[model samples]
Target: MRFLIIGGSGFLGAELARQCSTARHEVAATYLTRPGETTGVEWLPLDVRRREDVAALIAAFRPEAVINTASRSADWTTTATGAVNVALATSATGGRLVHVSSDAVFSGAAIHYDETCVPDPITPYGAAKAAAETAVNAIAPTAVIARTSLIIGDGGSPHEALVHSLATGKGRGVLFTDDMRCPVHVADLAAALLELAASEYHGIHHVAGSDAVSRYELGRLIARRDGLDPDRLPSGRRADTNAPGPIDVRLECGMTQQRLRTTLRGARQFLA
Candidate 1:
């Protein structure tokens, strides 16, 4: 199987590239600035925001599957338009597409969302993700739009780094007790995505961890896993802050999990 991973330098993208490469799949990963350190992958320079560049690359590579993990939380062009470009190129090339989405697409008004739930985004980032989903679905109706939650890793994720920094007094920010998400390990997510890409499934799927945890509790779990003092991690309510996003959006992955071989481990299980 030949694979093209868009935004391959990112946290989730890198994991996807690594897993695919390890499986002896022909892998080509794109990067905006610099490529990742993963060996055995053909690293290529790409800016998903540019439609021409994206179309040219996909046409040239002619990958059997293209997994789009690219996103910029604040940039609508990078997050929304970029996804549209990828979808168009993949569809034109007749390649299978697995578009990674986010739980941010929800407004937290429902707290729990299934694969059938309609997006009601509140924040700019959420709106961008929702727009991306709509475009991908429209352009490539057979594509898999996988919506996942906070992607945690083995001390490599941003939230884990933040926990280490705050625990050691290198960073100054409170982990929100009110903000909750179903965190999935990077390995599990990447594997599940690859499985979906190789399978005959299409449409929106909820891919997230089984347990929902607060950011503060997640920080404590990270701190404990890294041998840091969990008590040193400051905690506060996101409702008290001026943060603009959902408070407790949890993706219900039971249906998707039933289709996946990869186990989406929760924060407590993975960190433990």
Candidate 2:
């Protein structure tokens, strides 16, 4: 199958490109900045916010599957509408589309959330992602929306941030324990996204790690894994009063496992 991954230079997108190339699938990835070369994939330039660029790329490639991994993410207006437009442009060509989203879409009230749960995002980032999901569904109901949690891998994600902070030991020793998230490895998420692209399953699906650890616990775990001192790790901040975060944002993966029939590893497993 021919595949196109937007934002292919990112942590998740890079993993997807690598996996797809390993599987011997025809893959073409797009990037805004200078993306490093991959052995078996073609990297192209694309900005999802530009509809004409999206259209032209699809027309030239004619890929059977298109995955949107691009978003403003930090800004609501750009993320919501830009993502929506990209989805519309791609799906208009009749190819399957998969929109990579976040578990932040939820307000973190429910301990366990399935695809049917309604989204009540509190932050602008969450709101934009939620709105993008809605627009994607409306444009192509058959399109798969894979909502995932904290992505760990490569160098730019939260995982790297924590590791770097600890290694440098320059910042204040304050960990936001209140900000809860399931840590999903980038390789696992990429695998799930590919599975969804190959199958006929529709609607929202979760591709996340098995364990839900607190921010403080997660720091300790990483430190432990790296042979660092967990005792030096700071205590967790208050879950409610400290900052803005999801109280309990664990995703239910029953549907994903059953549909994709793929075995997903836990956070430790990935780190190992």
Candidate 3:
């Protein structure tokens, strides 16, 4: 199978590329600023924000599957419009599209969300992700929109880095005890996404971890796993701050998990 991973330089995108390459699949990945270090992959420079560039690249590659993990939380043009561009290009090329979405789409009023839940975003980043989901669903009805939560890796992920920094007294920030999410392992997410791309399932799919944990608890877990003092990690309530986002958004992935071979390990299981 020929695979094309958009935003291959990103953490999740790079994991997808690495897995695809390791599986002996013909892989071509695009990077905005720099390409990933994944060997055996044909890296190409691409900015998904450019509609023409995305179309031309996808048309030329003509991959069997295109996994889009490109995201710019602060940039609506990159997160929403860029997704539209990728969807249009993938549709034109008749390729299987597996777009990675976020759990931020929810307002946390319900606290729990399934595949059927409608998006009611509060934050700008959440709104952008919701917009991307809408555009992708409209443009490519058959595409798999896998909505996930906070992605944690061995030691490379942002949250893990933060845990290390705070534990070592290098960073000055409190991990929110009220802010909750179902954190997923990067490897599991990438594998599940590949599985979904190869399957006939379409529309929205909630692909996230099984455990719902608070940011502070997650940080402590990371701290413990990395041989750091969990007590050194400061904690606070997100409600006390003016932070603009949902307090607790947990993605329910039971239905999607039944269809996937990869186990979405929770933060406790993976970090331990």
The reply for model 1, stretches above 4 Å from the true place, is: none
Q: Write the per-residue lDDT of candidate 1 for residues 79-119, one digit (tens) a residue.
A: 99999999999999999999999999999999989999999
Please, what is the whole-model Cα lDDT of each candidate in the order they appear? 0.95, 0.80, 0.95
Q: Provide the TM-score for each candidate, comma-separated.
A: 0.99, 0.92, 0.99
Candidate 2 lowest-lDDT run of ten: 236-245
Error (Å) of candidate 2 at residue 39 is 2.0
For candidate 1, what is the TM-score? 0.99
Tens digit of per-residue lDDT, candidate 3, span 68-113: 9999989999999999999999999899999999998999999989
Where in model 2 is the C-alpha error above 4 Å? 154-156, 238-242
**Model 3 CA deviation exceeding 4 Å by range:** none
